[model samples]
Target chain A: MKTRKADPKGVMTGAHYLDGDFALAEGALAAGCRFFAGYPITPSTETAERFSERIPFVGGMFIQMEDEIASIAALIGASWSGKKVMTVTSGPGFSLMMENIGLAAMQEVPLVIANVQRGGPSTGLPTLTGQQDMMQARWGSHGDYRIIALSPDSPQECFDLTIQAFNLAELYRVPVFIMTDECVGHMHEKVVIPPADEIDLVERKWYEGPKDAYRPYKPDTDLVPFMIKTGDGYRFHTTGLTHDERGYPVINAEVQDWCVRHLIDKIDKNAEKIIKLEEEQVDGAEVVVLSYGITSRVAIKAVQDARRQGIKVGTIRLLTVWPFPEKRVQELAGKVKAMVMPEINMGQVVKELERSVAGRTKVVSVPHCGGGVHDPDVILKAIKEAVK
Target chain B: MSPEAKNPIENFLRMDRIPHIWCSGCGIGTVVSSFADALEKSRLDLDKVAIVSGIGCTGRVAGYVKLDSFHTTHGRAIPFATGLKLGNPELKVVVFSGDGDIFGIGGNHFIHACRRNMDLVVICVNNFNYAMTGGQVAPTSPEKANLSTAPYGNFEYPFNVPYLAEACGATYVARWTVLHMRQVTTSILEALNHKGLSLIEVITPCVTLYARRNRLGDGLNLLKYYYENSEVRHGADTRTLDIRFQEKITCGKFIDVEKPTFLDCMNTHLTKTLGEKFRPYGV
Candidate 1:
């Protein structure tokens, strides 16, 4: 009961507050969520259940929907109704959600979804943590579009950055993924809940008046249109087709090109702000470790340990993974003599690092694919081997 | 909003897209007549409504309506209608889908939406076969029903529409044959006002697709079959039809429980609780 913090009504946040679970769920709710509908799936089930219970208490709607498709469908429905909605699941549920995720993008529905990384091509390890959906998150559905994804490394990050994921999703009118591994999802730690007034919540930019005049798809100044919920006065018409400025479905080539290009440019031009990464002690360092999420956490510990052993080793950790920070990789790869990448998957992100850092430095992948996360020692070995 | 207007059908329909697509002797035309009659009589504001249709002969319902509409992918009208209703919460959202589209491939989505009792109208035109796909055997196709897939006879048991709907927790469920025009139309109007998952299954005949294969005659004879054999029981057991499960029961209002739907419960909870802890995180 040492860390049991109680609200005015006095039900201690499950694990009873100021703990791992509370930090994760509370972080999302505090970020201005009004709806959540998700089915229970392994590893990520608690996330959905936790939110469903908490949302009713806090005025948000959390629905334990029928299946993964309906779960995400309900999430999309809630989001269109002007709620910062989200759904959480691991492998199988994530796979079922892919088609609707494409629907979300084609229709430009803003949502916050978290795939707490699990071991899988198809239900490989449900209870265990692995970073296999990294590639799938990018190219899972059958279509053409880009995704904005983030990976939080710790329980504290699970709190602080889940809010960031929500803000980014609303800002872009795109589904923002809060990619967390089991290491981060389950690990117990303290997360300071910043005071209520301090946190900034971004509701979708809304139009002022009228049912007839609103073109649901086209926002005048910003490429991302101002979203008006159905109850609101604006009579918005949006579809999953290549729509014109009016948001009515159109199949003409010119409109199709404009819609696709602008949807991408809205992310690309803002890549600098969106693609966040940590450059750790790369100043005059030869060997660098390319990492992200749990692998980055391991690489950070390994980098520190390697430095103690006098191996001029530094690490590059990616916070935002979607618009893969190739420029940073290119810059670091040229300066460093060699880079070692120890990932949970069978070398997905390393190929990108290699593509960017080609011929500049030897890009080596220390990839492992089992159940649990790649340990710090495994990466420490890669660091030592790279520096050797 | 005049109930006795000239051509009540044209008031609800888009006359610009005239000459409907159902084959000349098809019963879908009769169902559409009932739907239009319902819409006109209900007097729902056209500007604030959306008609969502899936890919089928019935999918064309969206294009024929002047209201905001969508002709979406195959067998997804319910989920799409769910999206529109949840998104707007105020719009009079409706789903227009056919037998094969709703009960065959889209069965999972249909069952789930009913269980959720999402606030929307589901207008199911059960022609008993895939009319658009050249009359293949559907999930709701009559037992011993003939189709391209079942040349001899359908071995599988057909799903009774109201049974499946009521069992899946639909707030309001009703059934009527197309020839029972006034009953079917009134059911559609009532469903629109019900404020939850309400299904009005219209038993139509595919004169071009199903009739040629089953030798069930055209829409006129199909209407005769419905008129002659149908037992108008409000609580008939469709699965265990009285005569050894052979009778195709013309059931109605099977389940009309007033359970709190997803939207009703959602709004009530949100309006009460969203104030106490409406704070931002990581500020």
Candidate 2:
């Protein structure tokens, strides 16, 4: 696609050993995120700290708001003012941001929110890794809407995928989620950030015609509308209510149906273009191990061990979790005997896999309730049992 | 003459959105009138001005205004306005909502915004209850005041808004009843020109809810009560400004001083710390 040089001031073009949190901050700068508003929480605090330190030098603003609700609210405001923005928080803080997150969805404000997942169901484990919020990330806010969520497995992918998250957010005009865990957030690895010219970035499409003719909610061929930047002499009205194409509230069933369907179908209809996954050795395998986030890395070891034990086990690692690559799962289900899933929660994403497979094949879940990653031996036993 | 020809303020409002939801004799309309007068007199670029509001009876102000308005979620207008101002330092952001919105559910945001002195003009309409949701008791509900939730009369102590604003660090704090239209409009004009966080508490009569429940006749009777019992004490100490059940309501400018705003503090600190390497935000 189209590629251009990044702003030299924001690009830190080199290689360094860094944690996923730090890499995420660098990725934001390279992606032209000019404003960051966040509230500090464990594991996710480092990302905010890095933004506070680095954003000022790049001619950007970093504000530490009163709480997570204010943090996301500020990001939505900044995004409307024609700036790329983001916020970072963990479980409890993510819970607090739900209402404003729904506001962002209703207004179709483009922004990024990174959730460095820790154990939960009410702050279960703060300092430990957990994948308990996967389902929450998909349907955290009330109402019917769809969002793109990405999972990163390493510090390097944390850097690469965060840039992708911003691009997807701008492309669809929806809030994109970076669903990582405490393990990946704190783990240090070598991350190579390429030269500014090498990284591809997406700029928001601004309305250029007569300001009088601008319709804020009118979608283009791609189902994403052009944005009218605030204070550009194009004064307009917008709210968190069901609105018409002019962005004025229209309280009726027809308006509500039109609004909700666009919010949902934009991503649902374009699932193939938006979904991202990485597959290995599943062409003719009898069993496949499906996993994401930190569990995918651990599942690698389990799959190799199962292969050594004469079991034909394959692997599928989710890069984009939501818009769940269901069709691919449906096709793979017809050939494979069974699919095994191991995650940090009590089977959150495996539910989606089961829905896609729909009894065409056996679906097995190896559930863990936070605190730590699954032991490879535990997953290996599940993989062996699935083939039986 | 046509209806639009009769009202000179029609140009500043969304005329099609008229027939507003406010009840008869409710003083919120007068407050809106004063605000419109202030906006007209200021002569500032209306295109660059943005009004934000949270959910409540007063929250509908944004929908009625002709500026770049945002009707955000409940209790979130301040932070959202802070973003708009900082995102483009040229935008004059105003937050207008009811007392239950600004001080009850959104009290934390109000306190923090004042503490930072984020550049914004916050107009809090103190109707003393959550009138939109059928008159529930609020943080500003007078002690022993009658409300839906507090049917036995509210016994909880109410907030002294001026004192709270002063303690939290607002650069300008003022209170005026709806009867003092010219004075309240003048206060708003001053706040619009001020640089940092400025809060103007307008005590309005909620005719259908607060007034009817408390045995006040109508909006006119409550206005007469304010005219007779409310004492205009300019520069009064905010600590003694609490409104007891029918006691003399002390009103006027309480805190007016100069201090750097949140952006000023950020830019100054960063320029000194980073020197030539620093680039001021909103450039």
| Chain B alone vs. reference chain B, TM-score for every model | 0.89, 0.97
Q: Local error of candidate 2 at B103, Å?
A: 0.5
Q: How many pairs collide in each candidate, listed in order?
A: 2, 0
lDDT of 1 by residue, B142-241 (tens): 7677788888888887786777887888878777777888888888888888867898887776888777677777778887777566767775554443
Best by lDDT: 2
**Winner by DockQ:** 2
TM-score of 2: 0.98
TM-score of 1: 0.84
lDDT of 2 by residue, B97-142 (tens): 9999899888999999999999999999998999999999999999
Candidate 1: list runs displaced more than 4 Å: A1-21, A208-211, A219-221, A233-236, A250-259, A358-360, B1-33, B45-92, B112-119, B131-135, B144-153, B212-283
lDDT of 1 by residue, A1-388 (tens): 0111222221222332343344557767878776677788777777776776676556545667667877776676667666778778888889988887887887788887888877887878877888888888887877677779888887778777777887788777888887887667777776666656556666666666565666667744556776666545343445566777766555698988988886787777778878888887888897988787777776777788888988898777878888789888887776877899887899887887888877788878988794876778877887777766
> Which regions of candidate 2 deviate over 4 angstroms?
A1-4, B1-6
Question: How far off is residue A37 in model 2, in Å?
Answer: 1.1
